[model samples]
Target: MASNTGNAFDFNLFKRLLKYTNPYKGTFYFVGVAAVLLSFFSVLRPYLLQVTIDDAIMPSDNEGLVFYVALMLGVLLLEVISQFLFIYYANWLGQEVVRDLRVNLFEHMLKFKMKYFDKSAVGRLVTRAVSDIETISSIFSQGLFMIISDLLKMLVVLGFMFYKSWQLTLLVLTVLPFIIYATRVFQKKMKVAFEDVRNQVADLNTFVQERITGMKIVQLFTREKAEYEKFKGINDKHRKAWVKTVWYNSIFFPIAEMSTSITIGLIVWFGGLRAIENDSLSLGVIIMFIELSQMLFRPLRQIADKFNTLQMGMVAANRVFGILDTRSFISDEGSREVGKLNGKIEFKDVHFSYVDDEEVLKGVSFKANPGETVAIVGATGAGKSTVINLLNRFYEIDSGQILVDDIDIKDVKLKSLRSQIAVVLQNVFLFADTIMSNITLDHPDITEEDVITAAKQIGIHEFINTLPNGYHYNVKERGVMLSSGQRQLISFLRAYVSNPSILVLDEATSSVDSYSEQLIQDATDKITEGRTSIVIAHRLATIKKADKIIVMDAGRIVEIGNHEQLLQQKDGYYKKLYEVQFMAEESLRS
Candidate 1:
């Protein structure tokens, strides 16, 4: 939601953007050289016009006329070539810069702590990475290098005008200060407009993305009209934001055109009088001044427009840099390489809060010895999930010591620590890819054969083979192609193939059919045989055989024991929870 309200020309931001071009320096310099040549060739055309009229046509010299005409044609050809190079190379540099920037932005987002994503919207980030970065490409393709070429052309034209007649040149330039004042006002207004446009665009994208993602909910709840109204409101805001920019352009461009006309009128009037009064000012010189005046002032007009592009690019850079400057990365200071951990996890006196003062886990502690299956049961908001998040270091605990194999997890390399753990969430997510790819996740070392072997081990191989294309079947987005139980089965196969030292299944079988639940339970048994496993479930019956059971209530550990021991404790928290949260499942089983 941050808006850029800085100066119209932020040289600091511009300098930062230039650094991205370091990788494409050769193309960058080629574009620069092309701009210079383009300016030189452009200025040559007007000068040749003057020579053809004054020294060749006026003198009735056929030979001189032919030579000057041929020279003019050659200049035009060179200009065309330079223009092509300038356009092509500038665009090439723009594309390369944005490609690198988009990649860097995505990579940076990947390293952000889960807490950052918890507060951020997917659509807003997508806008930054896709649309805002694409707008930046125009800063080079249509803004920076074009501005340079225009300024150079203006300079060359001005030198020629002064060489011919400084008095006339000075006269034509009297309108320049007013034009500059107008352009400055336009740039400031456009910058604000552009910032609003970007913000509104992000809002629209976020709204549309969220609404479409939850379309089923909208239809099921019969809220289509309400959702449509909300979308229309956001769409209106986006439209209005764009209209403001167009309104500014509508005002600024006409003023620029009027200024240009005034300058041209001054040249024709003053140059004609001077030529009539004194033969020293030739007709060719007067004609050349008219053309040269346009050459000088046209760039100033185009610059007003290009400066808008530059300002928009700077605003986008500010937003993107804001994300890049975030210090929310989970610190990976641990140097211990966890090639293989013993899978012993102990959380000693841990406390955590997603928000500043509202703690979710309050001084809770537990230990899961290697090769043990620990089941955690609680009400919905009792922080069962927070424990899983902290164990994986997804969110750092406020005050705690989380140790794996006696070494604090904080002292282990992040990749090494995570590499040894596999998690299957209750809501399994599958990519829009073949089942094989979904299982292997494009892991370089996980082959199709390996995926098939793991699937067979988890007892889902036959189920997968029954599908249309077997393992090659596309699961589609979020694995919507498969039933919830089937997706859970695929998730289990995915974890099994990784061969992690520890496995975490957070309510992995909560919403599946009885048949799928039995299959999942079968797979769960095989997968957890010799590994440290953490099972978070609402079904007391499913976890009745767990090595240990931890009961939680309102962010506190209320009871801890094996299932039978906790169940035997009359009025114990686990017993009460089983009666409240799992009696229906127990009845269904009966």
Candidate 2:
């Protein structure tokens, strides 16, 4: 996360934000014109009142008074229309900009490397995508145009006051320096308060989202009381952040009101004393100055509040731009668009790490020939999963080359390379959608008939048919509706339907029951018939029939041969792993 510690009114950042309005330039210009028209209309009414008092009402001219009153009403109607258009178009433009910004932000996040997500919090990103962008919208709808419109109205009102009487206008000016100094102090304090408010909002959202997502864990471990305490602490911080803004508002508004009232009193006192002695200063002029004083001071008072809106928007824009400017995505510079790949893969001197100076794979090299099944066995944290992740370019390698069909994988287009491979993991993730939708992922090319055909081939068709609505059955979030075994079967069937040239199964059968294990094995046998396959598993019995087995320790391969060949070696890694681990499990199951 980035913190903004500079001036609140950042023009460069503001200029960058304005670029989003380029798409709706016509609306932007229309809103600007409406603001200007509103300012002009706002001042015309008070001038008409001055004229009606001096030129029509006092002289007892009935016809002149009627004409002037009618003109004043007409100006009021125009001002109302202008206000409506200004508000409507400004908000419409704000929503349009927000819609575009949200789309662009989402698309940018989708391309980021998996490593970036590994270090970032899900809820903070959600806050940026949703809540922060919403704050930026206020910049257009309330902050920018509203402030401009108010300032213009003040300027026009001041011009009319001075034209009527310089003496009265200077009296109004006498109180402004104090109000302006208070407003500046208020703005500086509010900027810091708003930044704190935004930070607290992100923290509250992150805490609540994580707790809700893992609610079962909280309850299962009897941690409800502890989690509630943590939540209360966070919620209290959020409340305190908002209260600071309210505190500043309470202090500032009263000062603004006092100054305006005193200025109005002075104008009346001075103008009244002059009107009684001389014919030059008339009663109409005094009344006009009173109305004009409010017109000028009211905006000055409200402008500080609107300026705070702009400050908050700038803070949000800074955070959003931080994410947008990140250079964490995999470089998709490959131009090779090979339609379909032949399933031959080789890792040559692959050295990689998730973090600097902490290598997970050190000069690890292996090759799986076309249409061969290679099983990789290793202990936890032994670089088994890192190999699969590297193959898919989820993260770039520090140094080495991964080749598919003798062409370097880095030279192949990312989507083209990934489309040829499929993976089914130990933990299956299914959306809160229909089973068929989860399987096809709404690929547009895949149909219900195709899914059913693939399901039957994988031997899970009977199981799916037993459920209500069959393929249409909703699998809720993370497939909680189904048992662990049933979810694994869905994942296996999903991988089979993709029909990739290479399939990687990472402990796909480890946690399931006997029935699902048998079904997954059947699906694995059917799917890996002619395609190149790489299986990573802890259960040695499952991979006993694999054409080749690679035993890894620490970060390097220590053994490579057929199952029997590796088992025949005296005190070998695989032989000890099999005898000490799966042999006991197999006996217990029997």
Candidate 3:
């Protein structure tokens, strides 16, 4: 989609990209001056040779020859210095620009709404941030600045050729239209080919990243062969995309090489005939034409190759900019900073949906007074999780007001609001770090001692100490080094250490062993005290002591009461759910 929006060498996109160079303008100007010097030096060498051959060698003046040779050597030295500065500084400028761009892009993504991530693939975004940005760097290092230098050098060479002999210059001009036309066609074709290549690369990255992440599922289900076959198909497509660009290059370069050969042949034939007929042309002039022809035509041929790099960089820039332009972030328009809320939460007739025309929460309303423990119980797809998501403002409600302390949450700074609450999700995630690091998440205010204190309060400190290194044990990625119950315990410690006024436990004890469940239940009771807690669980027994229970069915609250009050309604959804879960528990015990 990003490639589809722009031309191969879109001037508008190009100018927009140049704005990033404003920070590195000093280096950019240095590269520009280098280009001009390189070009001037390129033409000076051939002209020096012409003067040396015609004047010094013909008249047998050794001093004149030595002086011109020294000038030529000095010219070469300056050209090499200019070239070194051009390459080194151009790359330096490019790296600085992309470094700034990558940082800005990542910070922008950090503010995007949760729904944006839900709809995007992790691997494609990774490609945009990493490889695609690396390609844009080539636009400066190998493509744009280098092409400018080449073209300037070619122009200077052409001027020197005409100054020596217009007849030979005219002959060289005869081959220009055909090669230029061929270059135009090759460039257009390569643009499309390069776009396809980029698309295939992103697809390949996505497939590989997803498969690697879900390798456990593949192996558990014995789907290795099937997944491998699918990967081969994707890989074949990637190969075909790249082969298309290679095919275009193979056809274009040979034609350019043959054209260069023919133009040189024409210049020699015309100049030699002039030298024989009237002695109007010297051997030196003829040799200068030969050198100048290469200087002029080689750049034209190299431009086609460099243009491909430019085109590819442009395609990548389009993708990177596409993400930068996304407007999916939650509007943090509220300047109100409620320092340490009293934890009074109310949802007033909330209506919401993750997708259009399919509401997940329908006019759902509830209130948890300060320091009250509220429980929401329902089957899967009953919009129970949506309620918590809305509470955190992860997704915006369609038409509703969620208020904390009688202040509409929309009017509160997002950081201020989220900081006052802590959530322990059903699927706990821990970074690849020590247990202490994961628990504190490197929050400056939450120290290692504070984490240990919280863990002891929640009854997990003994379990943590039993690990290989106590609180310093590395959990590996996603806490794979720990059991499901162990990870859940760590998450609990994480929330407790935050010292939040409002606590949310979404199925925190659902998938643990009986012993771990008891530990978690004990931990839960300890943490929930004197805090406004929202417990979402399928297990009916977990929330019996909650001050209020809200039972939901099909996006609506079907019942709201304490355990005894809800059981009194025999035909209610809550009563039926309680009986089923109680019966299952009894059967397990028997």
What is the full ranking by TM-score, best candidate first?
A: 1, 2, 3
Q: Of models 1 and 3, which has the larger lDDT?
A: 3
Clashes (backbone N, CA, C under 3 Å), per candidate, total: 0, 0, 0
Model 2, position 126: C-alpha lDDT score = 100
lDDT of each: 0.88, 0.89, 0.90
Candidate 1 residue 163 Cα shift, in angstroms, is 0.9
Question: Residue 569, candidate 3: how far off, in angstroms?
Answer: 0.7
lDDT digits (tens) for residues 1-590 of candidate 3 = 33453345688778889999998788899999999999999888888999999999999999999999999999999989999999999999889989998998999999999999999999999999999999999999999998999999988888877787888998998998888899888888888888888899999999999999899999999999999999999999999999998999899899988989998889788888989999899988988888998888889988999999999999999889999988999989999998888999999999999999999999998999999989998888999899889889998889989999999999999999999989999999999999999988899998888888888888989999999999999999889999898898888889889989899988655568988888888888888899999999645456788999999989999999999999999798988988888558757767
- At residue 106, what lDDT does model 1 achieve? 91
Scored by Cα lDDT, where does model 3 land? 0.90
Give the poorly placed runs of model 2, Cα more than 4 Å off.
Answer: 1-6, 60-63
TM-score of each: 0.97, 0.97, 0.97
TM-score of 1: 0.97
Instruction: Give per-residue CA lDDT, model 1, range 1-590, as digits (tens).
Output: 23447457777778888999998888998999998888888777888888899999999999999999999988888888888888998998999999999999999999999999999999999999989999999999999999999999988888878888999989988988888899889989998888888899899999989988889999999999999899899889989989998999999889888987898888788878887887778778888888888888889989988988987887888888889888899999998997787889998999999999999999999999999999998888999998889889999889989999999999998999998999988888899999989888889999988888888888888899999999999888888889999998988999889999999987556578988988888888899899999989655655787999988999999999998899899989878877776776678778
